[model samples]
Target: MKNNWADAMRKNVHHLAGSLGNLLVESFHYLALFAIGGITAWAAVMAFLGMMEKGNITVDDILLLFIYLELGAMVGIYFKTNHMPVRFLIYVAITALTRLLISDVSHHGPADLGVVYLSGAILLLAFAILVVRYASSRFPSAKVPDPDATVKGALTEEKGET
Candidate 1:
């Protein structure tokens, strides 16, 4: 009887420790995501203000704003779904490369070889986005349930709804 009691106590302690560890990890995950989302929002606001102060928004400035928008959207989607949209990052890369290409061509003329390389990189990223989209569509994974859905389900059950 004493041995059984000791085993039960051990198991309970192990379970408690596991639960505590999971709670800590989940707390940290949420905190870090919130910090990232907040920073992205703040940086985007600052960049917009800078453009307003300049009073002349160039193509480069517009492209930079697009990059910021993609970053903010990526963060918001990740926060909502707990999944990173790889395509958004690819979109960001393509936009950044296009901006760089424009800047390089304007400063160095059309004879510069860097334009070709940047264009090639942008093309590759566009292809990668296509491939990712194809694979996701071909073999979609299970969707993550919405947090509110569970609460709504419980409420429905309590109300004796089918």
Candidate 2:
């Protein structure tokens, strides 16, 4: 009974914490929207200046914009789903890693390049799996229930069903 009381108290504390955290986060999101606007304007100005100076846009520099785009997309998805899918995070990480590798590969050789390529391949496979899993869950197909697996008796099978 004492342990049960402790568990109940712990749950109450967590519930209070979650409630307070949600309020604070929502307030911050509203306040931060103004900052986001200013930052986006500054980024656009910088991009325009860089384009004028170079006479052409470098894809390397555009990767920075891509990063910001991913951030905005992530926030957008969060607002839409109240939960962002892990695939977007994986895609963001993959792009960031690729950007880093591309920026630094001037001093790298075949072996180092191979390692980077392998890492990218692994991340790609993981991202693909995540996408497939998400698709399957979102569009579930007809599936038969397992034999002798009732709502409660999932482990213990019926005596004659074996």
Candidate 3:
């Protein structure tokens, strides 16, 4: 009986520790999400102000805005669905590279331009691969349905509804 009691206590402690760890991890995840959202907002506001001061939004400015938009979308989607699509990041990288190429065109010669173009092409290929991976079920995904949907479906089944 004493040994059984000790084992029960140990199991309870282990369960409590696991619960606490999960809580801590969830708290940190939300904190990081809020930080990302705040920084994205700050960047968007700064970009808008810069464009206002310049009196004209240049292509670089537009591309920067696109980057900000993609970042914001990434954050929002993660917050809602808890899934981060790799394609969004690839799109952001492509946009950033294109912006860099456009802004540095006057500073770079033919060879440098070729290198930049090649880099952009590589990014495009990565984006294509991600698209195909998502399009085909043969590739594994980290995405899962919302927990709320699972709960609702269970409740509906309990009620004898489809």
Candidate 4:
């Protein structure tokens, strides 16, 4: 009986520790999300102010805004679905590279320009690979169920419907 009591106490403590760890992880996740959101907002505001001061939005400025918008969309999607889409990151990278090329063309030599273009091409290839991977999947992983659908399913079950 003493051994059993000790074992029970140990199990309970282990379970409590696991729960606390999960809670801590979730708390940090939310904190990081909030930080991303705040930084994105700051970037957007700064970009807008810069454009306003210049009285004209150049292509580079517009590309920077596109990057900010992509980052915001990535955060919003992750917040809603808990999934980070790689395509958005790729899109942001492509935009940033294009912006760099456009802004630095006057300063870069022929070799530097070639390197930038090569880098952009490589990123485009990666994006193509991702698209192919997604398209060629015969059986995609199950998506997270919608909360409303879950509730409806439960209600239908309680009403004895199949």
Which structure among the candidates has the greatest lDDT? 1
Assess candidate 4 and give its TM-score to the true structure: 0.72
Better of 3 and 4 by TM-score: 3
TM-scores of all predicted structures: 0.82, 0.49, 0.74, 0.72
Error of 1 at 111 (Å): 4.1
Quality of model 4 by C-alpha lDDT: 0.82
Q: lDDT for each of the candidates?
A: 0.88, 0.68, 0.82, 0.82
Where is model 2 more than 4 Å wrong at Cα? 1-25, 33-41, 106-162
Error of 2 at 151 (Å): 32
- How many backbone overlaps does candidate 4 show? 0
lDDT of 1 by residue, 86-156 (tens): 99999999999999988887777664677778888999999999999999999898888764577579779
lDDT of 3 by residue, 1-162 (tens): 999999989988986887789789889999999999999999899989989998997888998999999999999999987778667877787788777777676456545756667576757768686776767667676667765578689889989999
| Candidate 2 C-alpha lDDT tens digits along 17-125 | 8778968987887567546655766775687687779887665667767766776676667666555556667666767766666666644644565666757775786
For all predictions, the C-alpha RMSD in Å is 4.8, 11.7, 5.2, 5.7
Error of 3 at 129 (Å): 3.9
